[model samples]
Target: MSFDHEQRRPADYAAYGSDIDAGLQAHMRRVYNTMCIGLGITGLTAYVVASVPALASVILTPPLFYVVAFAPLAFLWFGFSPQRIQRMSAGEATRMFAIFSGIMGLSMATLFLVFTHESIARVFFITAGTFAATSLYGYTTKRDLTKMGSFLFMGFMGIFFASLINMFFHSAAVHFAVSVIGVVVFTGLAAWDTQYIKESYRYNAMDDSANARLAITGALRMYLNFINLFQSLLSLLGDRR
Candidate 1:
């Protein structure tokens, strides 16, 4: 009996390990799928707003434009507040994310205004490829990314302040530097976020509701990374209209 129990223990452990691996994969797939849907919504919204002269005239104009520009920030601050997140159902979270994606699209409609369509498309592909490779590295690499993520976060904050200052100075040099640094920061963030999301599955997998919320939030993080990366690369590589 002792020998038989010992033999079964190893198989039980192996089966448990396999279950965990499968769960993690499914969680990651959910995260990626949600992120892709958000991206699609944002892209479709941006294209529609940019292509329609009536929509552009209203949205890209002064007062409404400010609303469009800051709406996503508003949602992030108020909609995703700690209390709100705790109470938010999976359905509500999904809807909120969708709305935020559309608002981001409105803000990003300026990209279409500033860059040629062909150049935008080209730079987008470049950004996509770069993001995928970096995220894959983050997912597969055994090395801890927590330290690297911390360093990159500080760099990101520096550039954020630098960008605000440049808004007043209108310095081309600062703009160029920020663009370059932004690309690097956001690209690194993509990897860091992927690793974070991958690791978070263990805790979140116990509850369906928790896992659903995690997927939405994870998607939002990755979506932001992709968007920032695309914008930074576009500024550096895109041809203006």
Candidate 2:
């Protein structure tokens, strides 16, 4: 009787474990899907805005240009402040993601004017490949990336400040250095954020509200990382138009 119960217990545990794994994978898929959709929206909007003469003219106007350029920062601030906007729903989150993507697309339209089409395409593919590989490694690796997150965060902030200062100084050397460091910082962030998102799913699996928030937040983080990395890499490698 005892032996029979023991054998059944193992089988039951195995089945339970399998179910949990499947659920976790499905949740992660949702997160990635949201991120992909956001990226698609951003890309389409960018192309349309850049190619339309009237739209480009409006966006490139001095005042409108500053607004479009700074729009991403505003969206990011709002997105990060969930506590201040507790009434926000998942649908609202999705809408925010769309709006943010559109803003980013408008900002990125400058790339169309600055870089050769072929070079931009090449650099985009490179960024996609690198992001995929890094994210996959983060998801599958057994090593914990949590410890590296703080260090990477500090590095990102430092680089961000330097980049801002360089805009005023207009230093070519500073720009080159920022691009190189920006690539490294964002690359690290991509992996760390992937791991953080995966672990967050495991931690909040039973809470639907938390899970929804995590999905949107994770998507936003990954999307930003991808855009920043792509821009940095493009600056380093792309041929100017």
Candidate 3:
């Protein structure tokens, strides 16, 4: 009887472990799916907007150029505001994601005008490969990335401030420095954010509504990280048209 009980306990534990693994995988899949859809929307919107001669012309006007350039930052600030988003429904959050994607696409459409098509495509694939590898490491590794998060956040802020100052200075050196730092900062953020998102699921898996909110939020975070990384890498590596 004692031997039988011990054997049954191991079987029970194994089954429980398998179930947990399956659930975690499904959760990760949902997060990635949501992010991929957002990226698709953003890319399509950018392409469409860039291809419209009249709209592109309008956006290139000085006053409108500034607005188009800064719109992504504004949307990001609004979308990631926890206090503001807390009151929002899941549908509302999803809508916000779509709106934010469109705004970002509008801003990034200028990239099509600035860089050669071949260079843009080349940089995009490079960015995609790097992002995939880093994110995979973050998701699969057992190491704690919590410490890396703070360092990366600081680096991002530094890059942000430098980029802002360089806007007025118009220094090519400054631009090059900012691009390099931006790529590094965002690459670290991609890994750290991926791990953080996964851990968040472990913490909030029990509440269905909370899980839905978290899924959307996680998607938003990862999407932004991926987009920013790609843009920064492109700035560094892409040839101008």
Candidate 4:
């Protein structure tokens, strides 16, 4: 959440504008590549756990399952806080991301149990396409998305609270509304976050350590958007097993 906005040297930019642009492109690719790797980890872990009956029974069953379900939240609170992230080395951040992705897979294994694999795959591709287009717009468009990001973040919090309430109420109508709003909110967030990350790179371009940490955080933001969008779309479109 806390990014160092150390401005790049004006002389350096004037002298090597092309080089700076190339660095920005490479930085964005690094962000996307890390996100894809995290997704791969999550997908593989989810499939392996879901395919094993014994493993599923032990981890996805009852009282112990809550531990798995909430472990990512605990990790975010204690390990991946802004303060902790600021202090982490590149290697440490990478390990944290891998561990978080695996935990997320365990939490989401129920998706495989509830929905047909074909529909899950279909929804994932749809989410990916939408993410790509929105992110491209964010990167290329002249319009500033900072204010939109703030508004969408508020909507995101409202959706979060509504989801928590619906978990207790178990209302079909609320769930439906939340799913629709979640899809919209996450879609917009994908663009906002992409623009935010792109802009941040301009400021932190000179520092390797800052850039390394920024890439991880940027990837984390985009990865969350993709996951939430995919889940929302799956809730609306996936065929139940």
Best by TM-score: 4
* Top candidate (lDDT): 4
Off by more than 4 A, model 2: 1-12, 79-87
Count clashes in each candidate, considering only residues at least 3 apart in sequence or on different chains: 0, 0, 0, 0
Q: lDDT by residue for model 4 over 130-174, one digit each (tens)?
A: 999999998998999998977898989989899978877999999
Pairs of residues at least 3 apart in sequence or in different chains that clash in candidate 4: none
Minimum summed lDDT over a 10-residue window in model 3 is located at 78-87
Model 1 sits at a Cα RMSD from the real structure of 2.4
- C-alpha-based local distance difference test score of model 3: 0.83
Candidate 1 accuracy as lDDT: 0.87
TM-score of 3: 0.90
lDDT of 3 by residue, 135-188 (tens): 898998899999997799888889889888888989999888888888888888
Worst 10 residues of 4 by lDDT: 1-10
Q: Candidate 1 vs candidate 4: which has greater lDDT?
A: 4
lDDT of 1 by residue, 1-241 (tens): 3687547687797887788789888988988888889889998899999999998999999889878887887888888643465578989988888888898898899889889999999998998899999999999999999998778989889987998788679998988999999998999999999999888877666677887788888888899889988988998999999
List runs of model 1 lying over 4 Å from the truth.
1-8, 81-86
The candidate, 1 or 2, that scores higher on lDDT is 1
lDDT of 2 by residue, 114-147 (tens): 8988998999999999998888888998999989
lDDT of each: 0.87, 0.85, 0.83, 0.90
* Candidate 4 displacement at residue 218 in angstroms: 0.4
Clashing pairs in 1: none
